[model samples]
Target: MEASAAKAPSTLAKASRERRDIVSGEVMDEARLIRFVVGPEGQVVPDLARKLPGRGLWVAADRVAVETAAKKGLFARAAKAKVQASPGLADQVEMLLRRRLLSALGLARKAGDITSGFEKVSSAIQSGKAAWLIEARDGAADGRRKIMAMARKQQSAPRVFGLFTAEELGLALGGENVIHTAFLAGRAAERWAEDARRLEGFSPLLPEDWREEPIEAKREP
Candidate 1:
């Protein structure tokens, strides 16, 4: 008889694995932390992929924590050597994260795991096929409300994200006015969700004002 195959852990369980923060010295979910490394030039670099070829220096993903690490010379202390972390390190990390998320979205589109436009997205949500709802950060309030309303009617509403601008969404997905999109259930969708969650640490998935409404949905698979 063949031995039983092991099951893969859910994203929630995987994200729960802890990593120690060099700045605060607190152990927290790895997803809530950002990793860094010292370059050959002795400059601190954000290793968002956590695969850079050096010992990692982890910090909480919050802008304040990143700023504190840079301003207080925590990267040098962690690296045990002189390393330059620019004053605008936090801004740089945020830019990189935004780019990474957009690129991942493009890949999802190429993989045919995404449906764009208001009509198709509405269909995806109504049919319970979408696992994520991607709304442009600059999208109109009426459009957002309509999508959220449809999501609320679902037994398992898709997680909503408003992290990219309409132009950015268009450029990434190769369409004009790509204000709303939906990620169908698949590996590509899962990958995009992972990057979106990582970027969420640096920025709110939805605007703070949206919190007053019932917008959130099911957790990641």
Candidate 2:
């Protein structure tokens, strides 16, 4: 049974590699092929978790491949009957990507590679160990402005991100309240950046408008 089951995947992979069109059917490329079973109303869902209970349909992860599948009614054909493809499938994938990035950031914080609060973060910067800067989305603008200036002076100016809210940053850093945080480059930091880049197709950072004002020196409290 194990051999048979293995053969099934090999066969599917091989078949997907070859381009063939059935009568009154559309031709599909191997790269864009995802096989999934239809649920009620013939819903075609890509189970990224690979734990969904049903046959799965295969499709490319990009917008173009999804559109092609819809345009050619390929999903229904694959199901061997009529099936309904979910609306806004591409948006669903993007949401999953964002969740993945958040999880990675949380992991980095747990590994002690991240520090929070104005004082701790400033120390990290002064020590020349911080790789990325994290600011709360709803943090005080004046405070953020002050920090951005200090970051700019560093040899490797840290990229500031404001996507996560203050509450979220606080939770990650194990603090009651946190407005600023810094990540040190290492395994954890690298993983966080990689996930962020994959989800947003770039590093998450504070908007240019937010960084317009230069940070100024202030008396230490």
lDDT of 1 by residue, 1-221 (tens): 13222333554466557778988899887667888999999988998888899998999887889999999999999888999999999888889988988888888888788899999999999999998898888888888888888898898888888878899999999998788899898777776666677666667788776643645643443
TM-score of 1: 0.84
Name model 1 segments beyond 4 Å from true: 1-18, 208-214, 217-221
Which tens-of-lDDT digit does each residue in 112-140 have in candidate 2? 88888888888888788887788888888
**Model 2 off-target regions past 4 Å?**
1-85, 202-221
Ten contiguous residues with the weakest lDDT in model 1: 1-10
